[model samples]
Target: MTHTAALALASGLGFGLSLIIAIGAQNAFLLRQGLLREHVLPVVAVCSVSDVILIAAGVGGLGSLLDAAPWLVDVMRIGGAVFLLVYAALAARRALRPSAMAAEEARSGTSLWPVVTTAMALTWLNPHVYLDTLVLLGSVAATHGDDRWWFGAGAMTGSIVWFTALGYGARLLRPVFARPVAWRVLDALIAVVMVAIAATLLHGL
Candidate 1:
């Protein structure tokens, strides 16, 4: 493979690995829904699809535009920081709130559209997603020169594989999350993760 191709492969793997390892809002929501064993497929499908679309858009031709438009990056940075901070506080509030004694399973009866809509909103609303996929990862792809498209494709491929694996894999933990404490613990962890991301974003700003 040419040098650019190799770089693209490595960068794609890096982008995927960076996201897969992070337990952010998206992953936390997925894990919670997964533990509940409700609407797992729809939630995961939405997350994966959203990622693909963003990655494609970022890589298709917007990398240079984003780079040139420094003001846009600044806007995204500030917006992302504010969003994460608010989300972090909300997560903490959810953690502190008392839960019902009964371990109520998430109602999976709703049509799949709710699942899809919620996932899309969560992923798309956060400016951090733009920072991660559109700015950071897209910039990496741009470095690949003519092979940038392949790099974008590879990065998106990773999202598809990951969400599918995580969604299906969560079924294995259904029994453990049957307890109310399990959910509280999971939510608490999620809160911590969100707070950390928020802190990081603020610090960077």
Candidate 2:
């Protein structure tokens, strides 16, 4: 690999990580799933694959498409805000019921389809994901001359690495989340973060 290409790859990695490594609805959901050791692989796969698709689209000129239809962003933004707010309410309700937070029962009883659906919604429904992976990252990738694909590859790699680590590494915190109070706190935090993000999205719109 050329040194310049390597540099572009590194830059893309940094950019991707910086944008995603945040306290958001998707990360909160993934963390919860990880703690329960429930549907972790599917959730991670959904998120990672979604990012790969978004990044690829962006690099392949989704930016131009987006610009041609600015209302698309607004539609996504509204849809995302509604989903986040609804999820936040659900999380807050969970926080209120420590007994229902039954990690064991919840994990065993929950089916794969619901988790997969939520993961997809949290990923694809979030307008920020579109803006971040499509507009911002796409624009940046275009600036990399002949090495833009390398940059896109780096971003894709970053998404995979971060999601894999977050999903699997959360097991290390299992001991902590084993306590009902810990679950309550985590749920409360998730609720707050979701609402905050939703508010920001609405405010921007």
Candidate 3:
């Protein structure tokens, strides 16, 4: 790659990682799925791939359409809020009734579809994601001129690296999460955060 392209890629990687490396519904859900060590690959794939699409769309100028439509953002906001509230309830229940990963896998009856669905919902349903990936990232990428794609590629790399680390690396914490109390704590935190995020979304609407 050229020196300019390298810089653009590095900038994109940094920007992408900064935006996603925070506490949010998507990360929370992914973390939970990772801890369970169930469908980790698929979950990671969904998040990483979705991010790539969003970043690509953003860099490709889809941001203009998304920007032009206020109703679209509102629709996403409402849907995201509703989904978050429901997810919060589920997290709360899990906190109240904690169980080991083994038992959860055995009796949970949670097939791949639901897990994938939740991952998609947690990702695409979130309004911030659209704005961040499409508008914000797109605008920033535009500053790179012809090298903007390099920036987007860098950002996509960041997403893949982050999701992979988060999903696969979660197994490293298995010892800590082995205790039911640890799960209860994690789930409780997730519930509280999800509710707070949902409330923020509603208030913004």
Per-residue lDDT for 109 in model 2? 50
| Regions of candidate 2 where Cα sits further than 4 Å from its true position | 103-108
> Per-residue alpha-carbon lDDT of model 3 for 13-121, expressed as tens digits?
9999999999999899889888888898999999999999999999999999976898888899999999999989987887886554345556544689889998999
Clashes by residue pair, model 3: none
Candidate 3 Cα lDDT to native: 0.91
A best-first ranking of the candidates according to their lDDT comes to 3, 2, 1
lDDT, residue 129, model 2: 91
**Regions more than 4 Å wrong, model 1:** 1-11, 65-114, 202-205
Question: Which of 1 and 3 is the better model by lDDT?
Answer: 3
Could you say which candidate leads in lDDT? Answer: 3
lDDT for 82 in candidate 3 is 97
Worst window of 10 by summed lDDT in candidate 1: 99-108
Q: How does each model score on TM-score? A: 0.76, 0.95, 0.95
The 0-to-1 C-alpha lDDT of every candidate, in the order given, reads 0.72, 0.88, 0.91
lDDT, candidate 2, at 138: 94
